[model samples]
Each structure stands twice: as C-alpha cells, then as structure tokens.
Target: MLDRDIAAFYGVETKRLNEKVKRNARRFPNDFMFQLTEQEWSLISSQFVMTSRMKRPKKSLPYAFTELGALMLSSVLRSPVADETSIKITRAFVAMRQMLTFSTLPEKVVTLAQELYKLKEEVNEILADQNDINESTRAQLDAISTALAELQASRSQDATLKNRRPIGFIQPKEDEE
Candidate 1:
C-alpha cells in the first residue's frame, strides 16, 4: 500500500504517517516498508489518476508498505482509529491463518462421512437379513447408527474447540433455584 493510502485508512496525514515510520525506523525493515522509486511512482501515478491528497505531494517519494508494515503502523500511530483498526486487523490475520491451517479438513471429513455411510449400509443389510430383528430392534439400530455419526462429527469438531472456553448450561445453586 502507498503511504498516502495507508494514511487515509488510518485517518492521518501522509506526512504524519511517514514521521512515525521515520521515528520508529527499526520497526520497518526493508521487507516491511520501502520507498517507491521515481519511475515506479510515475508509472503507478499514471496508471491511476492521483487522488486529491496524492496531487499535493511535493517531497520525498511515497513509501510502499507490505501487509506486515501496515500492521506495524497501528503500533507506531497513537490514534484511536489506528488502535481500533489494529485490533481488528490482528483478529482478521488470526482468522485467516486459522482458515489456512484448516484448509485440509474437508478431505478428512469426507473420509469420515464415507466410513459412516459404509458402516450404516452394512448394519442395514445385516438387520434386513436377520429375520429375528423386529421393528423395535431395527429402530434401535438406526438410532445407534445416527448416534455414531454424531460422535464422529463431534470428534472432528473437537479439535477446533480445544483452545476455546467450554460453553454449557451452569446448574443454579439449590437456594437460588
């Protein structure tokens, strides 16, 4: 992102944003942020008509910040907007990482679902062939199969809930009740 764009987002002047970056020079390494070359800036500026703020610029080249640098700006900037956005951006990053980490889950779930289907089919066939199994017995088997499926689903979901606080109904005190 360009310094002017990021400044606009953080609700600050482009110069002010760059001032913080300058003061906290150690925080913004080469990978985090860098100044755009004159040629690059001209090309970019030509590609897109300059915004109102961008038009008024008559100083050093604009700084280009990577996503990490954008986050780091929140820490350097001491504004309510920056602080709030920083928290939201941090949470968004965490959520994105979680999604990426769980990208392989569909395959596992499909495998479990297929196994459950095969098990249910086998149980159904066996119950069908057994003449002694009545309606009640068949119903019980169906209920058991459903419960097994629920268990498998819960087991898979447990991994995600492992780090979260448990949620459940809390029994009231006898006197309170």
Candidate 2:
C-alpha cells in the first residue's frame, strides 16, 4: 500500500503517524522500516503525484514499515481500530506478494514500460529536430527556385540585347583602317 493511503486509513495525520513510529523507534529495525532516500522519495512522488501540478513540494518522507514492522506496529498501537487495520494491511501485503509470485509478466511489464517511455521521449526529440531541419530545407529550396525563375525571365532580354548590338559596335580588329 502507498504511504499516503495507509496514513489515511489509520485516521491520523501523516506527520503524527510518522511521529508515533519515531517515538517507538526500536520496533522498526533497519530492515523492518527504512526512510526513503531523496532519489527514492522523488521517484515515488513523481509516480503518485499528478502531472498537471506545477511543482511537487518536498517533504520529509518517513520510514515505511515492512511486514515485520507493521506487525510490530499492531502490538504497539493504542487503538483497536489501528490493530484491526494493521491485520488487514498485513493480509493485503501477503496477497499482493502471492499475486506477484503467480504472475511472470509483472516484472517484465514494468521493465518494458520503462524502456518504452524512454524510447518515446527519444523519438519525439528526434522528430522535433527533423521537422526543424525539413522546414529550413524547404525554405532554402523555395528561395533557390525563385532565383532560378527570375534568371530564366531575364535570359530572353539579355539575348535580345546581344542580337540588337550592331556588328560595327563590336570591337574592330587592331589592324582595321
């Protein structure tokens, strides 16, 4: 279960929930519960948060309890509701693990999805670059075509001028009388 959703289920503020775990720190040994690193937190945040949100505000993400930690938490928690919820959570975790074991495709699907996302980004970047290059090439070709058309239109006038020139006006031989 996601930390946020778990927090909501326990009917406590996420900070207060973390504080309870912090106060009873020894129950959560390193393996039982661990704080998410900055990178791990960011990845989780990106996964959970909506893309439309402009910025993801950073927060002190707390230690997440594993199965052992959650069971230990059930013992320490003061409320009956929390204890009951913990049992349910534990069962859910077990069920999820079982489901994962049953499915061979889950791991492969995740890997393939990550690779596909990377490839899509690369392809989009390449297409944007290609579009820019193509536009420039088209503009250059249009300019060249316009210049050729103008040169062709002027060729007849130049030919007429050459034909109109008198032969006497042509340069005389050096020995002419």
Candidate 3:
C-alpha cells in the first residue's frame, strides 16, 4: 500500500506518517517499505486510474509499505483511531492471504468449460440421431449448436485474456494515424 493510503487509514496526514516512519526507520527494512521508482510510478499511473492527489506533482516518489511495514505503523502511531485502523488493516491482510491460499476461480472456470463442452457434444448427438426431424426443427437445432460454439469460444477468449499480463501503455501504430 502507498504511504498516503496508510496515512488516510490512520487518520493522519501523509507528512506525519512519513515522519513517523523516518523516526522509526530501524523498524522497517528495505522489504518492509520502499519508494517507488519513477518508471514504476509511471507504469502504475498509466495502468490504474488514480485520485487527483495521487496524480499531483511531487518532489519524490511515494513510499510503498508491505504488510509488515503497515503492521509496524500501529506501534509508531499511538492514537486510539490508529490502533483500531491497524486492527482492521491486519485483518484485511490475513483475509487476503487466506483467499490466495484457497482460491478456486480458475478451477471453477475449467469445470464450467468442461460442462459446456459435454453439453455441446450431447446436443450434437441429439441432432445427428433425429432422422424424422422437420426443416424448422433442424434449423433450430443448428442455431442452438451455433450459439453453444460461440459461447465456448467466448469463454476461452476470456480465460486467455485473464491469464495474460496487462501492458500499462502501448504506442499507437503509425499507420493508424
């Protein structure tokens, strides 16, 4: 998380939070907190829609605190509100960790794809076995099969996109201009 975000959560100004971090520098190692490089900041800004404050000009890059660094903040900030906010932050971190450990979205998507494939196969079999089918009925069955194929193709495309990493910014082709 960013220093400004942590300060907001703790009900303190960003300057004050940085001050506290500086005073207790020994508590936070390089891994616990670090400043974002200009390149990293630019990439992140381009990839994400940030608030006005974040987009504002600044002399230096903002500090990013790891979960341990955020936890260390509670010790440095001795206010009741800060303490309460720290507890919530800690809980959020724990929940995120747990969710990561037990995530099933990919598995669920695979299962759904398998089921759709099976259904498609069954539909195809039914269409093939229908010897006495009228023209309208055959057309309807063909439409259903087409729809299922399109749905499967769409799902596969979505899965591929989801797995692909996001590129923050791309230059437009000169030919397009």
Query: How much lDDT does each candidate structure score?
Result: 0.83, 0.74, 0.86
Q: Look at candidate 1 and give me any clashing residue pairs.
A: none
Instruction: Assess candidate 2 and give its TM-score to the true structure.
Output: 0.51
| TM-score computed on alpha carbons, candidate 1 | 0.47
State how far residue 175 of model 3 sits from its true place (Å): 99
Q: How high is the lDDT of residue 151 in model 2?
A: 97
Separate clash counts for every candidate: 0, 0, 0
Each candidate structure's TM-score, on Cα atoms with residue i matched to residue i, is 0.47, 0.51, 0.55
Candidate 3 colliding pairs, count: 0
Lowest-lDDT window of 10 residues in candidate 2? Answer: 51-60
Encode model 2's per-residue lDDT on 1-177: one tens digit a residue: 434556666777666667778799877787787887778766766785464123323555545667777777666666887888888988988998998886977788999999999999999999999999999999999999999999988997788976664567566455466
Q: Write the number of the candidate with greater TM-score, choosing between 2 and 3.
A: 3
Query: What local lDDT does model 2 show for residue 72?
Result: 74
Tell me which residue pairs clash in candidate 2: none
Q: Can you write out model 3's per-residue Cα lDDT over 33-67, one digit (the tens) per residue?
A: 99999888777767766544454456667899888
Model 1, 66-93: lDDT tens digits are 7798899998997799988777666766
RMSD of each: 29.4, 16.6, 32.9
